[model samples]
Target: MSKQPIYLAFSTQKGGAGKTALTVLVASYLHYVKGYDVAVIDCDYPQHSIAEMRDRDLKLALEDDHYKRMAYEQFTRLDKKAYPVIESSTEKAIDDADRITEQADFDIVFFDLPGTVNNPSVIKALTNMDYIFAPISADRLVLESTLRYMVVINDVIKKTGVTTIKGTYMVWNMVDGREKSELYGVYEQVIAELGFEVVKTFIPNSLRFRRELTETHKGVFRSTLFPPERSQLKGSNIDALADEILELIKLNGNG
Candidate 1:
């Protein structure tokens, strides 16, 4: 029997912080590379980006020789099928995740939630998650928005002792070498003072993050069906992020 699925979300009230991309990339890494049974509940309705990506991935794998061969070789090597990405509304996301997990033994179920907390269902869905990874960028507006959002999540909901959330983490995204390291340190210190822990792995800015598996592309970096190419993962810090998340999960007795 598999353990109860650990619910997680890469969330923040701020848009353009790479929540969907991180959700897909990290879920793929954990499922395909780290030998975990994973699924995703795409509750970002109207957009349903991850579910749409899955659709595009299927098409690409069918019509594109490069993707088809890559998919075939990867599936054969891993002896595992692609993880499920369920499109659902925020109100039904938890129930939908339960139904899917009941059908298959999944170690983790990642949720791609809406970018705003104004909706009651969004708050409900977030409260049910076992872990929340909020992405923050170096920009002033982004940081301020993330901080205010985290205050609601950390102080208002989680601290009230009414949620399943075990740990809420802040992840630094879009980190660039051109930026001063001190800027990050100062932000980290502020976040720490607010009693939030930031993940040690900082995801560097890279064009590969925006790339997808296409007919002409030689390597696949992000897909619902396959793990990213090792070369594409180079300098992305995804592996380290996965490791740190797993470590935190283990520490919380959920891994």
Candidate 2:
């Protein structure tokens, strides 16, 4: 059996790295696909992107005929309710998440944090995570920022000794397969030397990333109803990445 109420965060010190997107992707898979009880805490106080996405997903689940039917078909056999969406102050999101896990029958709690470490509140929130999975790109600035962010928080953990953070791992996001970049090779080397383990499953940059909810948005969630083989072609390697993450968590005894 899997562990109960594992708290995870998808964060980075740099913005526009698909933090919100991946949070919802894995949340959707865990709840709708793998049939686990899940909750999401949108801690981006200003943006509330995760909260908006959750509302969008709920609307689709309630209003779209085909989507509602698919959701019911998947959820009918389970005892869990529809996933909950929470909006919290950046300063209190971690404590709020702990309360949610303690009070709810959730298997996991996913936190969507803002893309900066300048705030003292955010640093405290980072120490609350049982695991932190950051999305990284080929950009030098982003790589540097994320590495620094990890080291800073790890130091906090060492100093405070008040966290379940086994370690932080980076996921390769927004890769363009048609063209190979020398920058990525260099980034990989530096990331390895920095002791950051980049996962093997890399997500390709795709149009499906932008589309959402309605027929027009064309977001990747629409494809979740498709068969597994078809969803694989839709350019979100999220499920594969989720599997790798689950294995790592279990092996680390955080599961």
RMSD of each: 1.9, 3.4
lDDT of 1 by residue, 59-93 (tens): 98899888788889989999989999999999999
lDDT of 2 by residue, 142-211 (tens): 7788888778776756457877787688988988884447877788888888777888888888766665
Clashing pairs in 1: none
Which ranges in model 2 have alpha carbons more than 4 Å from their true place? Answer: 1-4, 77-79, 178-182, 216-229, 232-235, 251-255
Q: What is residue 128's positional error in candidate 2, in angstroms? A: 1.0
How many times do residue backbones clash in model 1? 0
Q: After the best TM-score superposition of candidate 1, give how far the Cα of residue 109 lies from its true spot, in angstroms.
A: 0.3
Q: Where does candidate 1 stray beyond 4 Å?
A: 178-180, 251-255
How many pairs collide in each candidate, listed in order?
0, 5
